[model samples]
Target: MAASYELKASARDRVGKGAARTLRREGLLPAVIYGDKKPALPITIPLKETTITLHKGGFLTHIGVIDVDGKKHQVIAKDFQLHPVRDDIIHVDFLRVSKGATLTIEIPVHFLNEEDCPGIKKGGVLNIVRHTVEMTVPADNIPESLEIDLAKAQPGDSLHISAVNLPEGCQPTITDRDFTIATIAAPAGMKETDEDETEEEAEGEAE
Candidate 1:
């Protein structure tokens, strides 16, 4: 089951850059909630609670219950603005969701079976091309991470995005048939090639 977080929000009467900055100074983060046939509502949330919830992996993809003035609303973190220098969250955006709605989100990729991988045993290096992929899935069935097992992969072998085993009701947003997620390469041979190139360059300069 997907993880859930409960948050508290308050209606905001002030909007714009100055108001947002003022709220942040008071240890609050400005935010907005929209969707599900409702108009966008501006709100402010406690910075401490927002930071704690966001620290959880995949928190943005999980369902959130925002308590506003004693009323609860189901929403998901849709966007966030962060401080440029410190990278602290400055603002947030939430999207209201229904029970059966399908939402698209980017999920982290987890590489598994590395210890038993044939390529690594043969002194090959695994190159990860993508760390995440976008998927459209039922809100209730969002996966925390997509696992790709590389036990049987040999040097020069690659796993494409299509090869990933997704859970039921979850599908990748990318339709490209040849999108590679990871590849195993001959590390020793690549090093030898680099050495050879350096030697050739020296010889050319000597001539």
Candidate 2:
């Protein structure tokens, strides 16, 4: 699960493009918290702190408590606007997390035991179909990343979502069918060699 964090912010009375620009000049970024049947609260946080946290990865999935004056809001980052040139976060939107709320997020995928894979040891290429899987999970038990074991994977094997063992209370949003995750494909040269061999065998029979 992604780690939780606390950010200090001051409620901002002013809004609009001009007001946001002014806050940027003052080394603060404008952000808002909305949802869960509550009013949206606009606030400004230190630019340095926000930038550092965002670069740490999984910022959107990570829940945070934003302290505005004496009030704190438990929220998850929903969206953020970045400066086209500078890549600076100009504005951010956070959604309030109500009790028993489930979140939809794209969790990263990783492969384990690659060296032990029979396919990879035979010079087969690992072709990844999905680097991440979208899932709706309970906020309390969000998984960091999904791992697939390739220990017994053979060439031309298609690893599907059904192969992944998900955590309790976590479900993949894609439920219509068993989706493919990755495949161990035969090498390009090997494929060509097989084709050539097949042609040669056909010619031998014709002779």
- In order, the Cα lDDT scores of the candidates are 0.88, 0.89
Identify the leading candidate in terms of lDDT. Answer: 2
Over 4 Å off, model 2 = 1-3, 196-207
Worst 10 residues of 1 by lDDT: 1-10
In lDDT terms, how accurate is model 1? Answer: 0.88
Q: How many pairs collide in each candidate, listed in order?
A: 0, 0
For 120-148, candidate 1 gives per-residue lDDT tens digits of 99889899999988889898888888999
Instruction: State the lDDT at 109 in candidate 1.
Output: 91
Q: Show the lowest summed lDDT stretch of 10 residues, model 2.
A: 1-10
lDDT of 2 at 125: 83
Give the Å error, residue 98, model 2: 1.9
Candidate 2 per-residue lDDT, tens place, 21-69, comes to 9999999999999988888989998888899889998787788888889
**Model 1 misplaced regions, further than 4 Å:** 1-3, 188-207
